[model samples]
Target: MRMLHHGQASAQVDLAWFFRVAPAKRGAPVLVVCGSLLVSHTAKPPARKETKLTAGHRVAPRKVAGDLLVSGKAYANPAEYGHSRAVRVAVELGKWRKELAVFGDRVWLPGLTGSSPSEPLPFTTIPITYDRAFGGERFAWNPEGMGTGPGERGVRLPNIEYVERRITSPSSMPGPAGFGPIDPQWRPRADMRGSYDAKWLAQNWPGMPDDMDPGYWNEAPRDQQFLDGFRGDEAITIRNMHAVHKNFEMRLPGLTCRAFVKKTDGQLIELSMMLDTVAVDMEAEHTELVWRGATAAATPKLRDMEFLFTMLEPAGALTPPTGCYAIFEALRRKTYPTPEEYADDTKQAAKVRAAKAAEQQAATDKVVAEALTYRDTQMAQARARLSSYKHPSVPANAETGRHFSGIAGTIGPGIPEFGADIQAEMAQNWKMFAELFPSDDENCTWTRERVMKTHADGGDMSGANLSGLDLSALDLTGAKLAGANLSGVNFTDTWLQKAALSKANLSDTICKNTLFSSAVMEHAIFKKAVLTGAHFNRTQISGADFSELDLTGLNFEQCAGAQVNFSSAMLKHANFRNCVLPNADFYKAKVAGILFDDAVLNKASFNDAIGPGASFIRASAENLRARGADFRNAKFTEITALRCNVSQSQFDGADFSRAILTRANFSECKLKRSNFDRASLESADLSEAVLLEATATNVKFLRASFEWADLTGTDMSGSNLHEAGFFRTALKETKFVGCILTGTTLAL
Candidate 1:
């Protein structure tokens, strides 16, 4: 669960719930004369795409630079980002500048052509929209078809290419979102469907060694016990999550409890797990009283419940436990009987059933005697015999035309039309009466609340042709929405916790801060969608297509994201720490200062990512495709940049402290002032490295390539430079502090 240097992970996605909602009420039809799966349904209106550079098909060299899409206020449609124009955006950071090159309708980011200029680099994200109408999903939502939003069709995203240029100033829009002064809307829903439940605890916690055995008592620390059970791995997530106020126990029969969870390794930890049985709770009046005859009547009335709570909590870091007494009050059944009382009632029920059975048997005997008297005189009619057996076998069914074993068999020749039918009716009546007053059989079953499954939408959409619906802030909490064509739906601020959104066409959807916690968002697309603060926490987001989307300022710290397509994404200042991002595409992405600490990003791609001064601290980036990354002065402390394809990267003034660069390919990269202190670069390919004024204290460069490297004014104190190639390299003013140089080639 560590970060990779410049790679993404690959893992299979598990299926969760998918939900959908109806279209929006307001807004004129903005989509004109087109059939797009990613288009929304609205009242008929003029059609003019507000985004910049829409393409009719998946264009070649996917990321064109000149005209990047601009995000602004929400206009007429929720799916649209207003004021999008094809303008060349240039960023100037400190002493670097990166400019977008434009050509007609085809716009391109700085590094779209897989080429980097030999200059100081500035960070920038250039968004491009598709022209073709978007298609529908699981097949349509893969890495092969990345960056293609709702307006475009059949677009393919390629591996990233970072633009290497000079920056003069940071090109970030600062401050809070323009929707007024920022305040977290604490919407504590009283409805249980969007809340918490015990089932979540049972499913998530299970009987792991970290479970707490808090027995039922008058006073027991339930909430404390719950927290104690998940103090290890899961507790880390809770510590970093959004805190909330809630009761610890079941307030109703069916309730769903939800608390914001913190991400761990780019994924939700086991601690943020929850039960989803009672998603919503109803009033007490909804639970009706039942009378099992007059002798047994039960009502769910509230009574005062006082339980003593005890918990095992640490007094301090290493202090003695301080056991204290506290009172907890609860509302429970007013007159609920214990097990002993219920058993006594069961005995009474048995007596009543036995008396009724006796009365029915006597009546059956009298009828049989009367029928036998006229049997011989009525032309040899079969005498009707009343069954008086106790505890009969299973009753046979006439429906299947088959006789089953261990069941009662009926014996007869043919039809006895009129009188026999009448007798059969009477026998059925007698059976019903006997069942109502059974003979000494009393069974108690736990009463469960019946869940209502209803939704509000016009016309059954299960098989309807629908598109272009604005489903912003939709409340389909537990609805099943798998395989639905969600081409043009706007799911802004929607609550999809534990819901399924798998294989849905979410192209061009605005999913800002949308809650998909534990939802199945696998293989979903967000091309051209503004997913700034969306929470896919702990959900299966593997294989999701996020290419060509506005993923700027997105914080995906510590989450599972294997094989997620982020090719050509504008991921500036995005935090992707400790994530599982292996085998994902980051082809030509404008990713500056994107955190990737403690993540498993093996086999991920960053072909030409423009990551200037980005952090790779404590990351493990194996087999990464970082062709021309601008790692100038980027922090890479204690990182495992092993076997990566970092060719011609700008590593000037980059920090590589305590890093493990085993067999890493850093051919032709800038290495001026780039610290390799305490670094293990054994057998690493650093051939043709521009190592001017480099520092290499305690660095193990055994069998490494320094061929033709300019190591002028460099220090290698206390370093192991054994079997290193300094062939045709400059070594002016270099210091070798306490270093070993066995068989090191110093050829001119």
Candidate 2:
């Protein structure tokens, strides 16, 4: 009432002329728009609902856990990010996650997701920080979490997380939204959003079975992707102008019409598409689906209009590369700026050189310090083991705890490039590694003399901690390198004959055609390391560790080791068939057909070991003490053992003909297809053992004990028996074909 009618009408009079135009109905004029509309609408994306006309791909779903462990879990579609999230997630979810009963099956859970309680049990606050919704830095990136640490208990975890659940879908089919953009439910908040599929959305929002539910939001996978962008405590949000529906077109980079789409219907839709943004199936390392949702409101025209870009998730922040080597490379390029104080003409080149020298010295000192600290830690552990020396007949020599040297194979011609005239890049890398682990440089150096001498002659240094170093083609024949850190080093064409490298850290190292024959390398760590074409033949390396190392095409024929550790090491094409490896450990080692026939592996262990850890057996170990091992297809001929111990071993397809077992113990072992013809068993203990297809002829039996043993398909032909007792031994299909009977006794 206070305002005049004419003035009130002026306020309402036209600014509405700028209104956005809509498609004309019955050839009518479009509506006018006004206000804060940033961008104009684009064209409506075409729909290609080829769900019924698509094909399927055979894929396995894998559960990831531990360090780089992939569960062979296939998927209907493949996704990949090189070795970034895929590898990391694969390792964590499969091996370290949980037991079969813990998960509902098939929903590939990440490390940060709620874990099942089976093997790697899941908890509420697992201390992990994935999925971007971290409660903060509660969980650190620890490969050996809890008991998996180096100093922790030796509890070997099963790497493959066998996910039992299958991909399940809802009973009813989900229909598309009529003519509008995706509802708020389909495109929910970043932290509280479900998948693009309506079925998954239903799981998040219960009320909207058919209609769009505003409550729909992210669960685990989406939340993780969202957080990967924002990072830390920064708040981020993605806005879209229109609702999501089938009527809009999405435009994504790095994709084309030939690109196949993985639909929720478990098929690969061959129909071409145009999408804005896409959901990345990180595991398969591919863009699985093409999103479509952004219609063009045509005001009776369809020319060059505006584009309404729809962001899929919160904006992400780039994380810096944390790899030490990457940082070192950057610094090597002089990318690290110098100090501001050194900007004067008086302090020009000369001062720069001085500063560089100082920095180099500091780096060297730091590396030395770190090595010393590691040494101190090792000494502490050795001290703990030293207490056993008090026991008589067990001095527990420090050298015994470590393998120092072995009979190296003959040195071949010196490598061509090993001589001083190598590439500058190679030289710098070598120097860098030597600096990181200066202990390897006990007397080695890359100074004027060393470098110049290398140029004149051949460069060689084995049994050294060239970790984080670049040492390509260094002549290290007959070098002594026990317990060295060689991680991330290069040893292309390195000569390491008979080099003692026991208990050494060789993780992520490259050693192509490196000579390791007759080298004593007990208890060596080779995790993610490559030793292709390495020679370990006839090497006496007792108590060595070869875990997680690639030994593909390596020749270990006739290699000998006592109490060796080959857990998680790849032995593909390795010729260890007839090697002497008594008292060895093959816990989870990978092996292939190469050899192991008629060698010695007595008292060996293969406990908790599996394939990729497999091997062709062909060997025998006499007078050894091995517990828990697999020797499938091993051979034994004329093997005599006195006071031998073979417990908890697998000897499938082993032939033990003409062997002696005097005071020997074969307890808790598996022997299948073993031929023990003409073998002597005097005071032998076959307690709690499993033997199959063994031929025993002319065997001496003097106080032999077969207690609690399983003997299936044994042929005892022409065997001399005296004081042989079969107590608590199960004999199935046993044959004494033409065997002598003296003082052989059996008890039920």
lDDT of 1 by residue, 1-748 (tens): 1111111111211111111111111111110111111111122221333222122111111111111111111111112223222223232222223333211222113455542223312222222211111111322212122223343221222111112321212221111111010111111111111212343222321111123221211011111122122111110111000112111111111211111111322221111212211100011111110000000001011011121121111212311212121011111111344587668768888999999998999999988877876666563433333334344445434444354432434544445577799999999999999888846532222111101122343212232212355666766665456555556666688776766666666666667777777777777766677776877656677899888666777767666767988888888888787777778888888888788878778888988888887888888788888888787888989988788888788988899989998898887888888988899989998766788888888888888887546789988888887878664466788887677888763311
lDDT of 2: 0.43
TM-score of each: 0.39, 0.34
Which tens-of-lDDT digit does each residue in 1-748 have in candidate 2?
0000000111111101012333222222232221110111233222222221111100101001101111112111122212211111121111123222111112222245542223333321111111111111221222222212232121222222223431122111112101011222222322233243545232322122333232232212221222211111221121111123212222222212111222223232222112222222222222222222112222222222321111122124221323322333333234323365335434687888999999999999999999999999999999999976666444466647455443222445456556655776788999998787748655564343453354346444344445676666766665555666778877768776777677777788887777777777777766777777767787776766676677767777777767677766766657775777776766666654445556677666555554322333323455555455565665445665556665667766666566666677766667766666666667776666677666555676567666546767776666654556554356778766655545544321
* Model 2 per-residue lDDT at 35: 12
State the displacement of the C-alpha of residue 333, model 2, in Å, after optimal TM-score superposition: 53
Candidate achieving the largest TM-score: 1
Tell me how many clashing residue pairs each candidate has: 100, 110
lDDT of each: 0.47, 0.43
* Best-performing candidate as measured by lDDT: 1
